[model samples]
Target: MSGRPVVEVIDPGIQSTVQAWPGRTGLLAQGYFPSGPMDHLCFRASNVLVGNPPGAPALEIDKIAMSVAFLEDTQIALAGPEGIHARLNDVPVPIWETVRVRPGDVLRTANPGRPGYRLYLAVRGGLDVFEALGSAATSLITGIGGVEGRSLLRGDVLSALPRDPVSARRFPEALRPRFTTEWELEILAGPRSAPDFLTDQDWSELVSLPWRVDLNSDRVGTRLHPHRFRWANGGSIVTGGHPSNVLDDAYPVGGLLANGDVLTILGMDGNTSGGFAVIATVPHCALWKVGQVRPGRDTIRFRAVTYDEATALNRQVDFTIDPGRVQVL
Candidate 1:
């Protein structure tokens, strides 16, 4: 029905954008936000199912209820916090596994209002979109990559890069990350977790309690409620008015940043540097949990972990996402 193998957007869902693996890198120092997939495990698994190499461009959706039409034969897969409902040509299909489609085939996705969060869609070949700063990640912060650097809109067309098809596959059930509202994140001390600002007891309370997710949370930063820290300096700095204030510090992607009385979990599109103090940094392995969590409804508690332990956990996650571990269909 078309010339090049293409997918046409029928209804672009909210916050839906094209993303890729290992997003913009080595350039954050020069002011680029590394806007990649929110859920790395789900993103990676989708690519593997479709036989795409790492860095292949894929679609990311939040509260997905979108529709797209295929113009040719290709393979596709979906993955995320919880597999949402999808149908191909009005026939039910499943997530976390490869599905075949041909010309005139339409794929529609929607949530049942239960547990799904961020969802990813991958084609046999990655989507054909422009690259910015050597990446295809669409950073809404700067609007520099992917479909003119913005979330997808209806009538947008994406052609698949030239690639051969691969066999069908799915992620292993036992190895899948458990998506939940109450997230227990493993964190390590940050640069400003010292006694000069926050006391030892403050650090203890930060890790020991469940923090409420704030409605203000977004891709820039996830906000948390009730900043109940007993500051050693009485919320005062040499030139600051708030207890969490400190000199501008280089931002960490998963850092726990204090902004006034509200705490934030710095995200992919968050600030590169700021005046807030970062008391903890969530490890890469656990950051996916942050990406899938529901703001204004969910809660999170911190669990302190050493650097060595974090590294081990990352390795374990890597091993679990392997294609060999999932079912062969």
Candidate 2:
């Protein structure tokens, strides 16, 4: 605990946990993944609205009903997919904006239907926590950060680091994040494709067909499927039993990893090293789209992009998230 007590959880939504921005870095070799918010842009927007640093610890709600009681007066902000259900006590509260609260005020949210999956709630000061590996992000699979490295539970109390009072602010409406049923994501083709693995035809098909997000998808990875094509050279790589197995190699954080015919986009809690083959990498600029993907409803199409192009897109995204863009009220 690093500051004054601020809130108590009344309802812990599915997979809800404490998380911060840009999570633990330079420690992947220790088998710890940066279990930060699924949507970095949303995470930053929430923090900016409440006058907290971008990396301030906050609650990452997993698109389900949640409720919390304020233990003290403070300002808070919520951000996520465009149309979310939320409230302050009995009054409806706006999303992507800041709201002032008093002691005993209750903030609650309902399920975020198909539009998206995760939401962020940030206080005036970042949440108080003993940073594990230098972050407050939670790794549910390995019990790494967050409250004991697990999802939040009802009755949990939260504290916030002391910070100066900040006035109201909101993210622009035109710039808010949008969600759709289909997406065309760009990837840099292959650290493992080509004449040795994927033939020219195989490479063509990987990006041609639409892949649907599987229901089994989780924070660790977004599993995709169609089950229509067989790998042309999965057996060409080294293996223990499966054709897709290879000597364990550093896993590209947002790369397209293949285990047999199954395709997955490594996400926030995805592994750092694995024996599975990484065929293509989804650029960091485009990975936030992966966070909002709706299971069983969203479909993805891949396009090959150059590294320079990806970098340019990332810069564009950065501009959209700049603190100066916030509307002061």
Query: Listing every candidate in turn, what is its Cα RMSD in Å to the true structure after a full C-alpha superposition?
Result: 2.1, 1.8
- In model 1, the runs with Cα more than 4 Å from the true position are 1-5, 235-237
The C-alpha lDDT values of all candidates are 0.84, 0.84
Worst 10-residue stretch by lDDT in candidate 2?
A: 228-237
Tens-place lDDT digits, model 1, residues 1-329: 12255789999987788998778977868887688887787888888889887568999887768899998789999887555679998899988888999889999998886564788899888888878898989899998888898999999988887677887888877787888778899998977785877899988889888998897777888899967678787655574888788777688888999887788998888888878888889998898888888878889999999999999998997887776777887
With candidate 2 superimposed using the best TM-score fit, by how many Å does residue 156's alpha carbon deviate from the native?
Answer: 0.3
* C-alpha TM-score for every candidate: 0.95, 0.94
Colliding pairs, model 2: none
lDDT of 2 at 56: 90
lDDT per residue (tens digit) for residues 1-329 in model 2: 76899989999977788998888777788987777888888888899899998889998887646899999989999988766778887899998889998999999988556577778899999998877878888888888787888989999998998887797898888878777778888898778766556667777888888889999898899999845344555464346555567788888778788887798999889999988778899887788888878777789999888989999988987788788998999
